[model samples]
Target chain A: EAGVVQSPRYKIIEKKQPVAFWCNPISGHNTLYWYRQNLGQGPELLIRYENEEAVDDSQLPKDRFSAERLKGVDSTLKIQPAELGDSAVYLCASSSWDGYSGANVLTFGAGSRLTVL
Target chain B: AQTVTQSQPEMSVQEAETVTLSCTYDTSESDYYLFWYKQPPSRQMILVIRQEAYKQQNATENRFSVNFQKAAKSFSLKISDSQLGDAAMYFCALGEYGNKLVFGAGTILRVKS
Candidate 1:
């Protein structure tokens, strides 16, 4: 009954530097998602992956942010040339739902806090 | 585009008292789900309670319960006998069938002993 696991609970970087966040979802989970939370704000979806395919990623910043899920289990989100505004918490979540049952219950992991100077 | 709103930025509740967190959402989809998530200082989002739009019964879990008004598109969380552990940032989120969850700005709850 292990929950989703995320790495580097904290990260500090300077502007223009590249940073990456990792996520290991719960076992047997079919859907994975990445969210970004700014200070004093709720989380916003950045991308979602069903197995090896990214089903939704409309909110991801294509110019500097990219994500990948290999083997349909673990995922990695990368931000190149990070900006000062990139300082935020990156959250990872997983769900057992297949996106058809009219229920999408997600379990989240301890987010990675990124600080860009 | 749908949106979730939490007018209260912060609230305080005395220990052993009751407090209600208000949330309102805009969704055209008739069938959807509402959720309350608690984020502690650890930065983990934990599901507190959820209510399905189609269900008439409000969801209740331990000291947590939700008053869901589908017609009015309002979902509020009520914490009875609030404990110090209840202090955190609470987020109201909405999810449609097979769609992303829309989250509000969140409300910070302070518990005074």
Candidate 2:
């Protein structure tokens, strides 16, 4: 059983450029989340997807940031006209309920580190 | 809204010693979940341990354990026999089913050999 997989472990982009990160969640997991972690800070949720539907994305910057989970298995997060402040580690996590445990535990991937110059 | 706080920005402990990391959370939801995640230099977030809000018993995994105080809204992680491998950034998070995590600022733990 593979864990949540994210591609491009590290990315570098100039300001005003466009960048994207990809994530492939664990098999049979229905809930997926994208979070941004700045240096010395904890991860902040940017969006959440339940299958093909984005149930929560209020924290997402609508102007420049966009995300999609087309077939419900993989997800893509894009940042157009990236700014220096947008540089951070983008983390993807997935979780599901196991009947035995009443809690939903999440497994995270090796995040994509984005550096915007 | 849920918020998690970790007052310590960084901590250090000698190898083979014990260390305790403190965390406080504010949430109205009673039946939620709390977690401790470790991110090493590799940048992969790993689950260290978790405690269910409704469970009165503290959660223990090997040398890692959690002191969960539901009434006080405090969840602390105690690492016994701390090794060099335990050095990392530890984050305290709170979440519920169908919701995303609310994480603390994180504490960087340093192990001195």
Best by DockQ: 2
lDDT of 2 by residue, B1-113 (tens): 89999999999999999999999999888789999999998669999999888789999999999999998999999999999999999999999766788999999999999
In angstroms, the error of model 1 at A1 is 1.6
lDDT of 1 at A108: 97
When just chain B is superposed on the true chain B, each candidate scores a TM-score of 0.98, 0.97
TM values, all candidates: 0.97, 0.98
* Model 1, runs deviating above 4 Å: A98-101
DockQ (Cα-based) for each candidate: 0.79, 0.84
Q: What is the TM-score of chain A alone in each candidate?
A: 0.95, 0.97
Quality of model 2 by C-alpha lDDT = 0.94
Off-target runs (Cα >4 Å) in candidate 2 are: none
Model 1 / residue A44 / CA error / Å? 0.4
CA shift of A77, model 1, Å? 0.2
lDDT of 2 at B35: 96
Q: Per-model C-alpha lDDT, please?
A: 0.94, 0.94
- Candidate 1 chain A, which ten residues in sequence have the lowest lDDT sum? A95-104
